[model samples]
Target: MKVKMILPALTEAISPHWRPIKYSLFPPLGLATIAAFFQLDDEIVIQDEHIEAIDLEDEPDLVVIQVYITSAYRAYELADYYRQRGIYVALGGLHVTALPEEASLHADTIFIGPGEDTWPQFLKHWQVGKPEKVYVSRERSLIDLPKIRRDLIKRHLYLVPNSIVVSRGCPHHCDFCYKESFFKGGKSFYTETVDRALEEIAELPGRHLFFLDDHLFGDTRFASGLFDGMKGMGRVWQAAGTVHAVLQPNLLEKAVESGLRSLFIGFETLNSTNLRQQHKYHNLNRDYTEAIRRLHDLGVMINGSFVFGMDEDDETVFDRTVEWAINNGIETATFHILTPYPGTDLYQRMATENRLTSDNWDLYDTRHVVFQPNKMTAEVLEAGYLCAYRDFYRWNAIFQSVSTKNTWEQKLRHLIYAGAWKKFEFLWDLIIRAEQVNKVLPMLESVLDGFGKKSAIAIIA
Candidate 1:
């Protein structure tokens, strides 16, 4: 059997947003991981549309496409194009898992859960010419999964080419999260063996890696062992976890010693009531200041994630959240509007109340306000979302956060990263206006040159 596995660009047509920046930022690990599950005898070809254009002319017996909410329309187009050529097409990923019925219109076969469990069954059925319309697997059996087929990846295309996942799913069941819906249950987590994890890391080409877990320290025991094993590797890494997890005794200290240079924390809302309403009760009593202090003290730069448009949020929410992040010395902040994806609890409730403004999957990217909020109009929510980005990432705020806090190494890292995001905010324009990129390069160089000679221990020059 011959296969073509793809990670589609977010739209039917290419744009500056994906072509020049987003594609280079990360490799399509999802497609490559799924490729690992295919039999060795099956000839496999992979293309990440963000990195390269799709080859519709390639004749393969099977084509597997991963779909995300924003990429659904383009994925459907790809599927239709392949099916028209009489090639079998399979669709999976969070978007298709949420709306398998809609996805079935495009794909000859649809996978409803983790592709690790469903893909093999599809292959078995295909061999007999009895391909099922949908294969659903709600099992939580993720141990000893095969390592990703890194050979299939175009490593040089990604900014962070070395990526690995230590775990799958999160324990917390946030109402708006699709993890619970995809896994068919909340409060379940799965991990590969620690030794296997280390082996995968050691084999990768670079010293810097990204552990792609939604919550890296979700299982404390597993994390402890993983950290212990990683301590001797002398590599720098980053991962995401809940605020409460980092506060555990000696866990942060050990992780830092084990090359944990950065963390992506989901501080979804500053309002405690919004946290509770969304069932993220674990953050209820935790001190946000203390959490930031501990992480910064350990030299771990934070990529704080926040969301607006919750039920408790209003016009005041945007400024409050942005100001809180700035005052807290957050290195980088990502803001989003509340997006209730299909098949999640939040979507059901919003649908029942007739609060959903649109069913367009493309608008569900969190950059757009797809649902009506109880406290503000959708137009206001959209405007405020963009405003929050501008407020947090403005040049003045970026300089203050980088210059005034953290160690020199952390400061340099934060400066370069924050500078890149500021450029990204104007990337679409930068493409059309050639002079824009030229103007930003010198500013970025000045920032970097100022800190390059300083000692790592120096907090201020």
Candidate 2:
């Protein structure tokens, strides 16, 4: 039987400028791993609609879609389309895991947890013509499942062929985070027994690795052992970790020695109040300048992440954050609007207070505002985000940051990202203007309806 894996984008209409981009740079490592589960008798094809259009003419026996909250809408649309064409559709990933009932409306079957242990059973059931509504695994730890097939790696693009997971689950229970709910009781992680993980990494010809673990250094001993095992492999890798790991000078040096070139750190916010409120690990109260300098001195490029729209944040938060990034010499940073996903604590609290704007999952994309704010109107929050993006990616700011960074490669990456930022500037401006014209102005007018025109204009301004 033929099985096709379809990876849908966050939207169907690809901006003409975004089409030529290659998939390897930010490939869907999750769906690629699932492709390894099928047998030789089954024909497997992978389609990423973000880079190329999906051609349904090459029919398959079954269609599987992997998605996250951002891409949930596109996934549903694809599922509905394929199901109408008589294709058996299956949905998996964080979005479906959090809302199976909502997902089941579009899919014939939805896999709740990790697909490694449940996918084969799903396939077996499908072969017998008895597909179930939901396929779930109670396994709390990462099982020693099959490694991704290296032969399936596409060489034309800048993709990491050898991707592996060293651990799973996080202990940090941040209010605006889904990890807190996904692994509620406690943290859980399972390594691939050092030798096996090393062997898999060694087998890949690309010599570049992408560790999908949410936190690579969640366990210090296991992380150190994994680093030691990777020595002399002539491989360069990148992984996500908490600022606590980055602060450990010795561990940071050891990781550099083991060919670690880039590290993604969840700085979350520059505001100490927001950090303390969220209970984020690492000392947010510490001098961020010193912390960033320490990592840069160790030759590790830091990809800092920040979230906006916390209760403590106000209009000034945007300029303050941009200034922080510029002063710290942060190379690449991702700024996301706060999203309260269904299973997370933030979601429950907002729902209880009746602050949720709508149940439209499509708008749940981190870029949009889905809940009412305590401090500022949604328009101010939205405008702040766009202004921040514009300020950081301005030509002068980009040049200053790139020149300050240590290496030429680092400078080039920053330049490329800055160019991409310029292209998306229009979209960011549209989001800001839309909030002001459609929501903010109308609501303010309603509140000042009885007041004089002069007072209403003053209030708006």
Candidate 3:
């Protein structure tokens, strides 16, 4: 059988959220993971529309397209085109799982959740000439699975191609999280065995690994074993974890000892009411400063994440959050406009309250305000969101944030990582366009080494 898998360019190329370096950072590993289920002799090809143009003329035996909210329209058009040609097209991913009924309208079949078990079942029935119209994933497992086809990844095309995901779903579900896209009242959290995770890490050839897991420390035991196993791997890596995880004793030390130089943490709001309102109880009563101090003590440069336009947010929310982050010495920060994704609890509440201003999937990327804000106009929410980024990433703001660091090394690393990442878009765009991202990996690693050199430490008081 001949197969082709495509990840459509998200947010349309012209949308304001579109960033060349963001899309170019990693190849579509999901496609490669699914490709592992196919027969070894089957002809397979994968294309990331962010890296290369789709060949609409190709006629493959099967085509699989991954869809996200921002890429739904592009995915549907491709699905419709291939189906019109009497070709079988399978649609899956977040958007499909969230709105499978709508997705089914464009394809021969739609996968409703993680495709691990469902895809192989589809292959069996397909081989027997009786494939179903829909395949819903009921059992979620990460044990003894087939090797992910990393050989299929185009490493030269990505800046951080060594990305891996050892787990699925986070232990704590925030109201705005996309985990609901896959959960559907089913089990969502699972992890690879520590041995499997370490073995996977050993298979990679680079010194820097990006853990794409929603939360690397979600399973404490699994994380401990994984970190213990990685102690001597000589790797520098980045991953997202919760403030609750950072507050746990020994785990932060183990991760840092295992070469965790950077973390993406969600410090969504400064207000505790917002935490309860969003069911983010893990962050409630936790000293946000203690978490930051611990990570900084271990020399971890943070990419603090904050959401704007929540129920308790007002016109000052953006500036207030940005100022707090700057004062806290957060190396870098990500700001979102608090989108109510279609399948999330946030969406259900908004829908019930008649606050959903638009049902357009494209506007749900968090870069746009898609719902009615309780405290401010949608226009103000959108403007504040943009201003937060501008204010946080400005040269003066970068220098100000670095001052929160205790050591000159930490300060220097903070400035370099945070400034270069957001400020050098032209250089990044050129590097991505030329497909020479691999050339910069060594520089990234050296800079990260500096991030892990903090001279002081702190604990929760």
Candidate 4:
């Protein structure tokens, strides 16, 4: 039977500034890896909807859709469209894992947890004409799976190739983070023997590598060994990690000498109280300014992350964060509204308190504000988030950050995308605030009235 896998885009609309208009496709790593599992006789096609329009006329016997929360709506729409044509539809990925029942409405088969173990079983069942309603396996360690097939990834998707994952799970239980749910409360780190990781990198032709690990240097000692192995490979790499990891002097030096170029660090909020309450990794005694300075001194550019909408946050939170980022010389920053995703602690708390505004999956996008806030109205939270983005990516701010850089190319890329960031913030504010004012304000006011007043400053400080 003909099988096709679809990787939906984060959004249906393309941002010309962020993505090259001429080349709009991203390598669907998850779908590409799944395609590798098919046998030689099985005809498997991979479709990235972002790169090209979906050709429903191809008429595959089976269709698999992989989606994240940002692309949940598009996945549902595609599933419905294909199912109507008598195609068997299966749903998997982060969104499906979070809300299987909601996803089941559109899918004939829904797979939760890691797809590696369950996908092969499901395929065997399909061959026998006995596909189950749902297929789920206990989260498998990455060490159990074979090296992901990079050959399936189309060359066009690689501005810089050589993506590999060294770890799977996180230990932190951040309120707004989905990582806590992805691993289901347990920490799962897969140590793919240093020899194996480096061997794969050595074989790949690209000089630039992107480690897809949630955290690359998970265990400092293990990371040092990996760094030693990576030295001979002669490639520069980038990956995501926490500020705590970067603060370790030995790991920081090893990362820099081992060719680490950029690191994505989750600085989440400037509010220390919110950080502690959420159980985020925060060193209360250490100076954050000093930590940032140390990393920059080591020549590693930080892509700092921040989230707005904790009970402690107010209108001034935006300016405070912007000032913190600027003072520390953060190379790049991403600001998001706090989203209470299903299966997360924050989601359960909001649901229990009846602070959830709607069950619409589309509104759950991290860019939108979907729940009632304790310290401020929904309008204030939405506007504050937008203002934060605007203020951070303002022309002067971008210019200042980029000018401090050594290369003109880096400065140009920042300039090219700055306008798009501003537009995204403006559009997000309009949609989120309007939805709240028209539909959720009354319900929110009633809840807040009964909850009683407490100092927002005291909570966030």
Which 10-residue window in model 2 sums to the lowest lDDT? 443-452
TM-score of structure candidate 3: 0.96
lDDT of 1 by residue, 349-455 (tens): 99999999898888888888888898999899999999998888888888777775756566666777677666564563444234233233323333323333454
Q: Which residue pairs clash in candidate 4? A: none
Q: How many clashes (backbone N, Cα, C below 3 Å) per candidate?
A: 0, 0, 0, 0
**Model 4 spans with C-alpha error above 4 angstroms:** 12-26, 185-188, 282-286, 402-461
Sorted on TM-score, highest at the top, how do the candidates line up? Answer: 3, 1, 2, 4
lDDT of 4 at 20: 34
Task: Write one digit per residue (lDDT tens) for candidate 4, span 1-461.
Answer: 78888988766244643443212313677876677667767778877765556777888999999978878988999999999999999998888888889899999999887666778888899889999999876756555455555665655533333566665665555776675665653334556667776766778774566787777777676688889877766566678888778777788787777778678888888778888767685444556777777776666667788988888888888899987786566766888888998888899989999999977776776677799987888898888888877778777887776665555443443343344434454543443333321232222222212211433233223
Off by over 4 Å in 3: 12-19, 451-461
Candidate 2 lDDT over 225-320, as tens digits, reads 889988888667778887777776577777777777667888888777878777774656566677688777766666788888888988888898
Q: What are the Cα lDDT values of the candidates?
A: 0.80, 0.70, 0.88, 0.70
Count of clashing pairs, candidate 2: 0
Top model by TM-score, which number?
Answer: 3
Clashing pairs in 2: none
Clashing pairs in 1: none
Local accuracy of candidate 3 as per-residue lDDT tens digits, 88-193: 9999999999998999999898999898889999999999999999999999888878999988888898889999999988888788988766867567898999
In candidate 3, which residue pairs clash? none
Number of the top-ranking candidate, with lDDT as the measure: 3
